[model samples]
Target: MNRRDELAANLADVRGRIDRACAAAGRDSAEVTLLAVTKTFPAADVALLADLGLTEFAENRDQEAGAKVAEFAALRPGAAVRWHMVGSLQRNKARSVVGWADQVDSVDSERLADALARASGEHPLDVLIQVSVDGDPKRGGHPLPDLPRLADHVARKGELVLRGVMTVAPLGMSPQQAFDALHGAVTRLRDDHPDANVISAGMSGDLEDAISCGSTCVRVGTALLGSRRLASP
Candidate 1:
């Protein structure tokens, strides 16, 4: 099958999975939003996906995503797409990230939140506090104890809008367990900030588990875009 045809088939299958997941969870399919992670993929592929009716896309690196955003705009002018930054973001890269990303799903530190707030200018940047479900030091998120403070910090910032919480289910642990912990955090966040209702906790592998635990958004890569390609030289 051609690449486009392959993507079409893959998208349909992923959609079916999401539908079934939502149905099994006794939730509406509209409760889950699919974010296609386009990191390492070229803008041409993104354009094709746009044509396939994907309005939301994500990237982990600012440098690559900035270029892709520009290229995508050039390729499909007036395309209404929402770009999400889903990778670890350094404080220094805040300006570059806020330039293109519609939402940032990995804000884990007070420093990063401050940086994003400062760089956001007149528009309030939508943000999700990355919560470390396993408390893994190597992971990119604030511990459960620190989440409240960080969420408050983001909510207090005029340039940053605290939208919700995000977490990656750790390896060697139950995905449901991790997501349930994340859901707990989301519950507390909503109690303080009712608008902070998003739960971005799923990926290509454990989306159903995430949805079962109240995930509002799933960041899917391989299931939609296939294997990762080496970066262009």
Candidate 2:
């Protein structure tokens, strides 16, 4: 099959898997929001998928994502997608992100949270604290040890709504380990912020484990888009 055809098949397969996973976990299919990680993928694929009834798209970079969002809004306004900023967001880029994205999945620090809050103003953007379930300092998320203080900071910010938490598994660590640590982190966050219950974990490969551990959302990419390519709109 050609690329578009392959993309359609991939989307179907991933959706089927998600449905089955939720069933196995004794959860409703709607409970897990599938965010197509369109990071390395280009705009045409995004347009195609959006036309195919997939309305949630995610990207890590500001430039590419901003371009794609603009393109989709102009060309495929009917899509009405919920864009997710799924990467490390710099403090300076907060305004741009808050302007376009419906939700940001990687608010890792109090400073970033404050910046997003200020930039959001009346917007009250939805945010998730990126916890380092991977235990990698080089990565963007806060360490699990610092979650409460950071969550407290997020709660105090009126412009940024603290909806939940997100995490990425370490490159070498097992998926179960990542899920366990992430779920534990969620429990910790809920101790004080009981409403902070969303766990943004899992991906194309480790989604089953993520759901088993109580993930409310799974960011799926290649399994839904074939491989990915980084290109401008």
Candidate 3:
């Protein structure tokens, strides 16, 4: 099979897994969004995936993501593709990114929240508070004690729609443990922010665990587009 065919097959496999996971969780696959993480991959691959009907994509870097967005927007006008900012967002570049991204998946602090708010005035912005599942202070997410305050702050922004929570499961720990902790956090978040029900906790490796723990979205990369090849502008 060609690369495109292989990609189709791989996407199908992940879809099947997602279906099984949703069934096991007493949920339906249709309710969740499968974000094909096309990070470090070329715009060509992204274009191909778009042709394959994957409307949502996640990217971790601004430089790469910005370039891809420009290229795709140029190629496909009014194409219904949603871009997600799923990495550490730098404060200085907040304005530009907020303009392009449909959702900021890593709004971990009140400062970034304020920045995004100011940048997105009058523009609808979906935000997910990123939680570091491992309690790794060096990492980018906020501490458990600080989520509600941050959520409330983001909610105040007319442009920022606090949709839910997103987290990276702790590395070197059991996947189930990590997803369970995220699930607990999500449950608490949903209590206060009823619309904040999205749990973006799974990835290519531990997607099943994430699903079992009721993850509403799972970010998958290599499993979808094979290995990525970075392209230059």
Candidate 4:
């Protein structure tokens, strides 16, 4: 099949999965946003996906995403696409990231938040606190206990807007268990910042579990774009 045709089929199938999962969870499918992670994929695919009706796309690396964003804009000048940074971001990359990303879903430290805020300039940048379900720093998330302070830090930044929380299910725990813990964190996060309602959990593997446990966004990559191409040596 041609790439567009393949993407069309994959997009349909993934949306079907989201619908079924939402139905099973007794939630509206519209409540969940499908964020396609376009990392490692070429910008052409991004344009094709946009034609396929996807609006939000994410990338893991600033270098790849920076080029892709510019290429996509050239491909479709007026396309309404929202780019997101969903990977572990270094503070040094903050300035460049703000130039391209519409939102960032991996703010796990005050230092990172401070960097992003400083680079955000006049426009307030939207960010989600990454919570470590198991409190493992290696996995790139703020421990549950420290999230409130982090959230407060983000909230206090005039250039940053606290949007919500995001987390990957730690290897040791089931997606359901991790999402349950995330749901609790989101609940507490909302107490002080009611607008911080986004729960960006799940991917291709465990979106169903995330939906059941109240995930507002799912960052899907492989299932939508097929396996990623490895970098050339």
Among these predictions, the greatest lDDT belongs to 4
Cα-based lDDT for every prediction: 0.91, 0.86, 0.85, 0.93
The pairs that clash in candidate 3 are none
User: Which residue pairs in model 2 clash with each other?
Assistant: none
**Candidate 4, 124-200: lDDT as tens digits:** 99999989989876788899888899998899999999999999999999999999988987898898999999999
The sequence of per-residue lDDT tens digits that candidate 2 reaches over residues 6-64 is 88888889889888988998999898888889887777888888877888789999888
Q: Is candidate 3 or candidate 4 better by lDDT?
A: 4
Off by over 4 Å in 2: 2-4
- Model 3, residue 101: distance off in Å is 0.6
Decide which is better by lDDT, 1 or 2: 1
lDDT of 3 by residue, 1-233 (tens): 88677778888899999998888889888877899998888777777788777999999988888988888887777789999999999788788897679999999988898888888867778999998777788876987667788888888878789988888877678989988987887788777789887888888988989888888899999889776687647
- Look at candidate 1 and give me any clashing residue pairs: none
Q: Which ten residues in a row have the lowest lDDT in candidate 1?
A: 224-233
* Weakest 10 consecutive residues of candidate 2 by summed lDDT: 224-233
Against the true structure, candidate 1 reaches a TM-score of: 0.98
Better of 3 and 4 by TM-score: 4
- Runs with alpha carbons beyond 4 Å of true place in candidate 3: none
Which residue ranges in model 4 land beyond 4 Å of their true spot? 230-233
lDDT of 4 at 171: 92
